[model samples]
Target: MTKKFYTVSARYWSTLDSVEIVQDGEKSAKFNASVITAPAEYSFHCQLVGTDDLYPAKLIPNDDEAEKWDVLISSFQIQGFNIENNQFSYASDCTSFFTPGIWMGLVTSIILLWILTYGIHMIMQLTTNSRFDDPKGPALSVPQTE
Candidate 1:
């Protein structure tokens, strides 16, 4: 049952990075990936590190078929994380993943707001405050007339 899916136009960051593998512009996989295992040829084992849905699927190969199947299963793993460096370098391709303009717009808006706020803060500091006259005391405190 080959259901056609359009992948997002993205490429892997590198051999070390992870990416979202969506089906037909959605993160939802078409196949029921109910199994997981290591490659049969080698003693290499695979542990499913992540999934979008809580429907977790983790497996280990006990037989040859299960091991061969692991190759197919590996393809389903989305979102690679670097445990060593503690960083996230996201994958590029995903022309199939949903291109919701709203999501993109929201991200853009947040960035713009940050830039604007930062500019305002700098401008206010430059105009109102000096090294000697900077307000170090509480604003609500009444001056004790000595």
Candidate 2:
């Protein structure tokens, strides 16, 4: 099998004091403020698959390659709160149900329903016999044919 390469680049405005790479619940590599300031890049290879219908695909590190992606921040503290997770949050790329096409369809259906209702009302009005109408003269009776 061929190897797949993935690149991740991030730029943050927050002051990063230090970064730590933890493996097996222990710190494997630690970089201080000076190292974090320098321009650098890190690459890792992992398996990714479709998460669900909503989500497309995501990186899944196996047991043998999990450690390569386990980079934890040692000094990532904000107001005495520790934010050490290094994984990016998953975001779905799927289209929602209420899209433009669906909206157009809904609007069309509403218009058609309104037109149908109006047509029915007009037909009823046209076919209805008004009891308030005055008779022009005496009613004429048809001659019986035996």
TM-scores across all candidates? 0.22, 0.27
* lDDT, residue 65, candidate 1: 35
Candidate 1: regions farther than 4 A off:
1-99, 128-146
Clashes of 2: 0
Best by lDDT, which number?
2
Candidate 2 lDDT over residue span 25-132, tens digit each: 963544333212211122211222221223222223323434345332222212112223664222222234597899999999999999999999998877543334
Candidate 2: minimum summed lDDT over ten consecutive residues — where? 35-44
Q: Over 4 Å off in model 2, which ranges? A: 1-93, 127-146
lDDT of prediction 2: 0.38
Best by TM-score: 2
lDDT of 1 at 46: 33
Provide the clash count, candidate 1. Answer: 10
Instruction: Give the alpha carbon lDDT tens digit for every residue of 24-128 in model 1.
Output: 674332223333222221122233323333223433333433433322344333323232345323333313344578789989999999999999999887763
